[model samples]
Target: MLFDFDGPICHLFPGDTAKRVAEAQVRWLEERGLRDLLADGVREEPDPYKVLRAVDLRSPGSDLVAELEEHLTQQELGLVATAMPTAYVDPLIRTWSAVGARLAVTTNNSPRAVGRYLASRGLTECFAPHVYGRTPDLHLLKPHPHCVRRALDAMGAAPDETLMIGDAPSDHVAARAAGVRFLGYARNARKAERLRAAGATHLVGSLEPLLKVVYAVGDIKAR
Candidate 1:
């Protein structure tokens, strides 16, 4: 099983932290006279990763992009303390691991941040080195399937046998590209609508149902 870090696992930024981070990134660029690098639409983006991607698109392979990516990573690392784990996800992850299911976290967030958060939750062993996250290569971020493919290769798992749970349309697109089954986790109506519009047919509003399924499977195996 492959999980997306920011949503299915935890809400990494909480309330307005992500928006503030994006604003800070813009300010950082403006201070360097690089504000023009961002398009009008991207300048106001609340997701720092999207802001980083916009800068990367304009100046790919530049020191400026690298620095900005690192800045975003630092902000993410700082937010880990206040990140909220999705309801039931801790138990869900634990139960899945206990049932002999191999788990990995594939995310656009920094691997360092993912590792720290998982370690804090005592979930490091559930995924460990199988965590594939953002690299210096901004283009590899999902909806690209790069991280998902990395997890599959490391685990020697087939795409057909793997399942990916993510909240975004990009996750859906990436899973389809990689030939993996996709399960959408939409915590709200707005999120559900967005996933539906992205052509995602299978979605859960919460992880509780999945937890129940895991319990049933475990019971069946034990019997």
Candidate 2:
């Protein structure tokens, strides 16, 4: 199982905290006289990932892009302290592990941030050595399938044999590009619509149903 960290695991930013992070990235760019890199209204954009994407578009593979990614990673690490835990995720992860499932986390969030959050919650060992996430190269972020490809390669699992659970269109796109089956986790109507419009046929509002399926399957491949 390949899970996206931000939503299926936990609400990475409990509130509008990501707005602050996005604003910080914007300010950093402005301070460095890279204002031309930002899209209109980027300062008020609530999604930090969008900010990262904007910077990357203007400066792909550049040191400036690398610096922006690091800044975003730092912001993510800071949010880890107050990140809200997803309901039932603890038991879900444990049950899947007990069933002999090889689990991995594929996220746009930095690997360090994922590691920090999992460690803080005592869930580190469940996914150790298989957390594939953002790297210095911003071009490799989700919708590009870089992290998913890395996770599949590391696990020695074929795309057809694996499943990805995520909450965003980018996640669905990435999973599709990687040839991995995707299960959408839509916490709200807006997310549900977006995922559905993106060609997601399997979706749920919560992870509880997934837990039930895993329990019934008992390590047997159902995909």
Candidate 3:
């Protein structure tokens, strides 16, 4: 199973707390006289990943882009203390692992941040050495299949046998590009609508349904 870290595993930012970081990145660019990188309303956009994407598109392969990405990664690492774990995520991870599933986190968030959270939650063993996340290259982040493809390659898992559960259209797109089954984990109606519009056929509002699936499979295995 390939789980997207931010939403499916936890609320990376509660109360849209990432806005400050996004604003900070914008401010950093502005201070460095890179104001031309700003798209309209970018300062007000809350998701730092989008900000990074904007900067990356305008300044790919530049040292400044690397600096900005590192800055954002630091911001993400700093925010891990307040990140809320998604309901049932810990047990779901443990249960799947117990049932012989090889899980990997495929996220746009920094792998270090994901590792920090998992280590804190004692989930490190559940997905050791398979956490594929942001690299220094911002363009590789999802909406591109780089991370997902990396995870699949690392696991030596076939696309037909893999499943990708994530909360965004980018996840859907990445999964499709990798030829993996896509499961949309929409926490609300707005997200559900977006996934639907993106052509996601498998949608779940919560992990509760997946828990049942996991337990059922485990039960059969035990039998």
TM-scores for every predicted model: 0.98, 0.93, 0.96
RMSD of 2: 2.6
97-205, model 1: which lDDT tens digit per residue? 9999999999999999999999999999999789999998999999999999999999999999999999999999999999999999999998999999999999999
Candidate 3 lDDT at 175 equals: 95
Encode model 3's per-residue lDDT on 1-223: one tens digit a residue.
9999999999887775778788898889889889789788876789888988888888887898889888988888887888889998889999999999999999999999999999989999999999999998777889899998999999999999999999999999999999999999999999999999999999999899899889999999999
lDDT score, residue 117, model 3? 92
Model 1 C-alpha lDDT versus the unseen true structure: 0.95
Candidate 3 CA-lDDT value: 0.91
- Name the runs in model 2 displaced over 4 angstroms: 218-223
Looking at model 3, residue 219 earns an lDDT score of 98
lDDT of each: 0.95, 0.89, 0.91
In model 2, residue pairs whose N, Cα or C atoms come closer than 3 Å (at least 3 residues apart or on different chains), thus clashing, are none
Which candidate number has the best TM-score? 1
- lDDT at 29 for candidate 3? 89
**Model 2 whole-model lDDT (C-alpha atoms):** 0.89
* Model 2 lowest lDDT segment of ten: 214-223
Off by over 4 Å in 1: none
